[model samples]
Target: MKKPASAVPAKKRSFMEFMKRREGQRGLVIVLFMAIPLLLLAVFTYIPFLKMVQFSFFDMKYIGDRTFVGLQNYIDVFKRDDIFGALFVSVYYMGGAVVQLALALFFASLMVFKVKGDAFFKGAMFFPYLICGIAVGFIFKFFYARGFVLDSLLQLLGMEMEDIPMWLQDQRINNISLAATSVWRYTGQNMILFLGAMMSVDSDLYEAASLDGANKWHQFRYIILPSIKSIVVLNLILSISGSLSAFEPPYVITNGTMGTGTYFVIMNRLAHENQKVGLACAMAIVLLAIIILCTVAQKLFFKYVFDDGTADESKAAVRRRKMEEKAAKKAAKSGAMAQSSVSGKGGQK
Candidate 1:
């Protein structure tokens, strides 16, 4: 059977109409503009990510023959207790990140209400972030060294050497100290980000809330937090992933020694020092999966909890009630029909 000419041209005509639309033309232009960056991302990010995933499935050193090992590499990651123990170090970093965010939020909230020397304080706070990671590590190493900067400052505050504890030597405290360095480095950045988010919020809203007898805390809770929820959530996600992959402070200061080895540091050592590249790749893949899972979980959690899924919930509840009512009515009707049929049959009998 021959296709109708009209039908054949319909798809083409629709496409032509779409192309003729101004919105379609603008979308095409936007896509054209995005192509280069998309290509670069695919080449740089996605290609490497795929290669890492492939590497996870193989047992191969950097120089040796690659053999398919399937899940062995992944299994190896869990079999060793060190990998899990290394993850425990992330707790310290995560705790520090939370503290950093809290401090940042506190400072940003206070500073949003017009503070004296704001620029100076902002600059001072942000300066550490501007410093190179290695330089910061070196600086802190010296600062935390015995009878050095931190110790000296503490001594001036009337703490004796006997009373003071070693910052980097003690396993119990070294991870905390290292994590603090990250907090010191990142807190200002988070504060600035939060301050920016807060500033963008409608000033009129705050004024109106205040006019309605809302206090600072009330205003913050109802207005500022809601406005900056996305930013806060984003920072938290980044903080979580970054904490899990912490490497620089421990690498530069403790060199992954004294229980300061984070997941990435351990992976780094496994890959380079131990030359167990496949195992390291598997570890990396696992960590990446964990990070992705955490991010997805946070996004879904926020969407459900804060993104007002109430409409959907209410709609679902209404649908369920309607379904139940319909089923009950149907059942009652069926029962009545069956009873009438039985009575008719009996009467006939």
Candidate 2:
């Protein structure tokens, strides 16, 4: 069934007409837009994750004969004290995340108002976040090294050198020191995120609250907190997940010694140094499960805390409601004034 030349033009015209239609254009656009990202996600994220899951079940190295050990790797992940105990180290980081979030919120709130040298302060705060994590690690390593930057500063404050405990050596304070580095590097990032969220809040709400005699604290509590709840939740989940997978500061600063071996550092060591790839994979899976559980738990906690009837509403919805209420009140007051004027005119007559 060969088509003639004229018939081929007719077919081409029909195809062009189809392409001109909205549905065809939409479908074409969707396919074009989604194809690359989906392909990349499959290739990079999903495929690798599935491969890791499969690898968790086998006894293997980076390159070697694989033995089908089934659940032995999983069992060994739990049985090994060194591997499992590393999870406790994450508690320090988690604590640091709390401090980080608090300081971020405080600074963000301050930045929302007019302040002196606002741009300079913001840049100074955010500069750490811009620095390379490895570079920041090395910087702090030297900063915290005995008789270095931090020690020199403390000594200038009339504190004896002997009175100053080793920042990265004393087991009691080394973990805290490492955790503080994480806080230093990340607090600025959290502050910037919080500031963006706060800046997006309706300014009208603040003005109205001010007219209603709401102080800064009251305005922050009732209006800002409610409006930015979603951002707060998002930050909390990310911070918690980051805490669970902390690696850089400890890895670069301390090399995971002095009771500072977090789960990721231990996993790295096992997979690379010890060549326990399967055990490392199992540990990864376990960490993934813990992170998922923590995320779910956090979502549930936030849901419960915000279980007011308006919990499902977004920040925009809250702002819209307030605007509507304000409009309605203004209309009522105008109507009352009109009625009062008519009543006075009637009495005069």
Candidate 3:
């Protein structure tokens, strides 16, 4: 006797049939086309990284061929006394990143609150990000070159134009000016990211908190803070990486000078002045290690911060399932009522 149709392994057959279906076949072709660029990207990007690792083991010279140097280049960065000043400048650069990130978060919070003219405000805030870093550097350079603000302030204080402090001329003022320019350009991008993250948070949570007599500050502290914790971690990582790898702003403004330049950052020191390819690779590796450590620290920090928190993956899943179940029941009940009405009409007729 022949077996029933349902007893056959129809699932595997159906999957294979679906693969051959015309609609899915076009999607498969499109997917392959999209994947080609991704394959090229992985090869070009990761192959260079691997080559850099190999180069870091060799003593690269300005002239002729390179010799094997092992870890000597890395040792120089840590052990050299001359680099101490640059290291100090790296701390100052960190200060710049912190200022940029904090201001970005503050502005993002304001934008998330649905303030008046929010669209225009967001566009104005983010306009700087559209301009090139070099352009920003030169624009600020011109702004400082004018000496108008300084001269005016000095004049108000009963002093002449001669008494005004030159912005780019002095080392301390130059660093601060570079940092301010960097912040002006990059903070908008960060603010947009934070705003996007804030907008995704559950509105119901905010409502619940409000119902519990939580004010705006309390809601922010209890609800908004916990919801956007992941974004904060992400921004921290970006800020740290950007701080460690800072180059364009100082390079443009100060022309790579010692005190005035951001080339004090390890990556900058390795690339421009030192011209040590091996050491630069080693620096890249060190920076990579630092980033990893920071990510781990952030994970721990988030765990600690969220210790008293309410959000959980399993709880969210349960809530979603219950909502879906309720919707399904309501749909089934409506269908049953419609069918009953049709049967009653047929009997009456």
Q: Indicate which candidate wins on TM-score.
A: 2
Question: What TM-score does each of the candidates earn?
Answer: 0.77, 0.81, 0.70
lDDT (Cα atoms) of all candidates against the true structure: 0.84, 0.84, 0.69
lDDT of 3 by residue, 108-165 (tens): 8777665998989889989999998789878876667745654566678898776666
**Over 4 Å off in model 3, which ranges?**
1-35, 81-84, 146-164, 202-213, 263-275, 306-349
Q: lDDT order of candidates, best first?
A: 1, 2, 3
For model 2, name the residue pairs that clash. Answer: none
lDDT of 2: 0.84
The whole-model C-alpha lDDT of candidate 1 against the native structure comes to 0.84
Cα RMSD, model 2: 10.7
Alpha carbon lDDT at 16, candidate 1: 71
Better of 1 and 3 by TM-score: 1
List RMSD in Å for every model shown.
14.6, 10.7, 11.1
